[model samples]
Target: MRKWGPLFAVSLAAFMLLIDITIVIVALPDMASDLGSSYTDLQWVMDAYALALAAVLLGAGALADRVGRKRVFIQGTVLFTAASALCAFAPNTATLVAARALQGLGGAAMFATTLALLGLAYEGRDRGIAFGVWGAVSGAAAAVGPVLGGVLTEHIGWEAIFFINLPIGLLAIAMAARLISESYGDREARIDVPGMVAFTAGAGLLTYGLIRAGGHGWGDGLAVGVLVGAAVALAAFVVVERRTAKPMLDLGLFRRASFVGIMAGGLFTQFAAFSGFPQVSVWLQSVLGYGPVKSGLVLLPMAATAFVVAGAGGPVMARIPPRYPIGGGIVCVGVGALLLTMVDAGSDWPVLVPGLVVIGVGIGLSMPPMSAAAYASVPPEKSGVAGGALNTFRQLGFALGIAVVGVVFRAAVENSIDGTPAAGRDAH
Candidate 1:
């Protein structure tokens, strides 16, 4: 128990944070109804968490290195657990969004240190076993999130989804403190404050702009201004990265075409795979009148199949060239997403199954190799940064995907009802 206790703790953190990502999908409608949330507020409920995680992840990695991995991990777990409590008790959408963002910040800290802690705790074949178990836990989190959320939301209430994290988190913190030894990287490493700020601001502003534009249209002055601000902040991020001594993200990485491709693949893999689910959940509950449990069940095939494939085929995928699996897998995801577009107003949940399965297969095929490929793309010294950057892009992709899809979905709905009686009808 002592030997594997660190893996258990790290896996607990991964499960909590990753599960939180999709758990809310099944509970969104209930939350909106209780909190009087608008569609934009609903989007923020998801976006705020993802944006914060994406923005802070790299910085969190650096901070963990400078401080101690176990220390930061514990701090993050405490914050995340506290924030989960706040989320459960939030009185309104605004407060809930704030709490969720806090959760994201904490999640970033824990997430950025999980692998490092595991690396420090295990050796050789034991390390491989730890990683395998961790990977399984990560996938299980996704597979179980919606279903668990559904059961809790339906039987207990939406608050239970967030509330459930508290005990799990506390257990993790206890195990981590006692079992996980502290580890550090280069003591002289700088935190790259300027770059962190610029990247966070840029990502946050861009997400806000997208959500605003989705609600108010591109001509809205505030939306346009926010978008411009995002552009400026992102440009500043590039400049700061170039000038900073020991930058958070090394700009030289982009020079390698393989690295660039791997990063792009990571981004789109997440976007195409998971981002549309929130809206899909809303449709299941609000439009189709399906109960939360049924909705979660409908979504289970994709995650479950992905879990199975990744576990069973991991060895075969390891032997293949990274491109064949990653590229072909991404293509599968694209085709799967395309299949989903075939749905009409009369379509049932089954319409989603084929696409979901294909996407699952794609995810399973692509995910295992992505990290290994990312590490291989850069020099051994730079592999950590490369891994961090890939995760950043993946999270950013999810955040942006939700916003972008919301805008397009809203436009399509409005267009469909442009001259119909429904065009001017209000829900009240």
Candidate 2:
């Protein structure tokens, strides 16, 4: 119980950080109005964080191992707290976006360390339970982010969303310093600098291309150049990884079929889940004419259901094969999207609840098992790298998901508007 206390506290911090990633979406309008920014700037407010997170995660893990995980974790907490304060006080979109990017840097440090900490603190069933709890807490945070963001934005201001992290970050730092033990990965391995650069460049370019294409069309010259640059950079990354003595992400990990399948499943599940939420939130606000707080309230059940279901996955895994949960969970996500597809301008809270609940349960079941499976497949020495790689893919998937779904939603909204300009204009 004593050991578990630190694990729970760190996990809670992790949950808070992850939730902050999406929570700001509900408050975007208020933020834009307050700061007097354009839509592109609003998109930057989200993308900048994600880009920094994805860019630094693998390198951050290696750095954590080289230094001390506890030391790095505390540093990350301090940085995140400081960044949150900056975000709270940001006077313009540029400042807010810059602060968010710094926040992501801190978040990447903590995220890379926390999973490794979990690996150290618990074993077997206990470990499974810890991971389950981690997933549940994270899912719950994501679920409630909208509601919480909405309430804070409405009652106080958009700044409350960023300010809220200060206490949580401070508490996490204090607890980590006193309670957590130190851990590290293989220090002897050489850093794959070229691979890291190539991968980061590739991912950034690709993400930029997708996002720009969504707004400006694929024919846009900048979008076309970005896409080409991404492809070239990715090819160079593969080459660097193959030629390098020590690669950040070992290509050989994919040889194991179970690992490959589970990783693929993880990517797809995140892609689906990440894409669905923002689209739903937009529909709630733009189409249904709900205030941010009301939309958040409507999302509450989804988060609660995910928390309950995800926490149960650990116990269930003890009795059943992981594939059952993974497959079933993926199916549920698909079904939830299908239900969301049925949404129209007139749809209400009751009509949305069941689908959101189903989606949450599906996500809860899928995420933990996939993570556990991926972690378990690697050698103990390589767990840090493997975990880093898995998270990188998941982040990549999330970035892509947002781009893809934003495009879809934009197209749908435009088409709907084209059909009836008055209705579509009203909806926006």
Candidate 3:
């Protein structure tokens, strides 16, 4: 229990931040209505948080390693809590978007150090259990976020969602400060400012292009330029890291198959979840006409399956090679996603349940072990960098997933419209 305190504390903060990711998604409509927003405003609200997180995560991780994880975590808690308050009180769309970016900055600091803290706090088997527990908390947060947001938005208004983070963040900060021991990364590591700059800018460009292109149209000159610029910047980042004496991110981590596989798993996990859930919510509300409460309740099986499997799977993970849980998880996701294609426009709960549960279970199985694998692949001194890398891949996966699905869905819609008369197509 003593060893678990920091892990739980960090997990609490992570859960709060991740929940904020999907939570705001559910409140998009309410926020748009209240702010008298155009489509662009809503996109900015969502994109701001993600982009900011991606922009700073590697830097935040490197900073945490140098400065001390506990110190970074405590500071992040304060910043995130304050940002949440700002978001809650924002008078309009612009203010809310700005506040969310601030929240992401805080979140990045907190997230970057979590696994590092866990790795230091526990050893071997205990570390495995800690990852499992952390993964369970993350799974639960992601699973419940949309429903919680819906309930809050339906009853308490959109501001309530952001306001809800205040207490959680404060509690996490207090607990983390008290329980987590201080730790630093490599003792002799120097700040690699150029590498950090290139990596951040490169990742930021790629992520923003993937996200913005979904809505702005793929052919948009800015999006194309952003994508091209991302490629160039990332190439430069590689060059800088290879030549620099002290690099923020070591390029060698990718050499290990375990590390690469874990990264791939993380990406695939987010790809499946984001590709399915938010879009399905639209179908549920717009097509099936389910209320917020009902729609939320309907997702309970998916959430619960993840929670249960993750908690139980820890011991199992300790006994087996990580490949089973991680690979099996992806396979489950693939199969689940395929099953979801059977969901006709007129489909009901029975059609949705199988796909959701399977995907949830896959996420449950994969995330915990994948986390452990990534952490295990690196030296303790590099936990911060490894964590940042893992999350960056997952974030990229989320954006790519949304973009691919959006493109496919749009094509389908266009095809359907093409079948209609020219007048009807023009009306649409």
> lDDT values of the candidates?
0.78, 0.78, 0.81
| Residue-wise C-alpha lDDT for candidate 1, range 172-240, written one tens digit per residue | 999999998877766687778899789878877876776677667678899899989999999999999
Best by lDDT: 3
Model 3 TM-score, 2 decimals: 0.93
Top-down TM-score ranking: 3, 2, 1
lDDT (Cα, tens digit) per residue for candidate 2, span 140-194 = 8878899899999989999999999988888888888878887766777776778
- Worst 10-residue lDDT window for candidate 2 reads 417-426
Clashing pairs counted in every model:
0, 0, 0
lDDT of 3 by residue, 225-339 (tens): 9999999999999999999987888788778777888888888888887655656665555455565656666777777888888888886787799899899989987887887
Better of 1 and 2 by lDDT: 1
lDDT of 2: 0.78
List residue ranges in candidate 1 displaced over 4 A.
2-4, 119-133, 375-384, 411-428
- Model 2 ranges off by over 4 Å: 411-428
- lDDT accuracy of residue 316 in candidate 1: 65
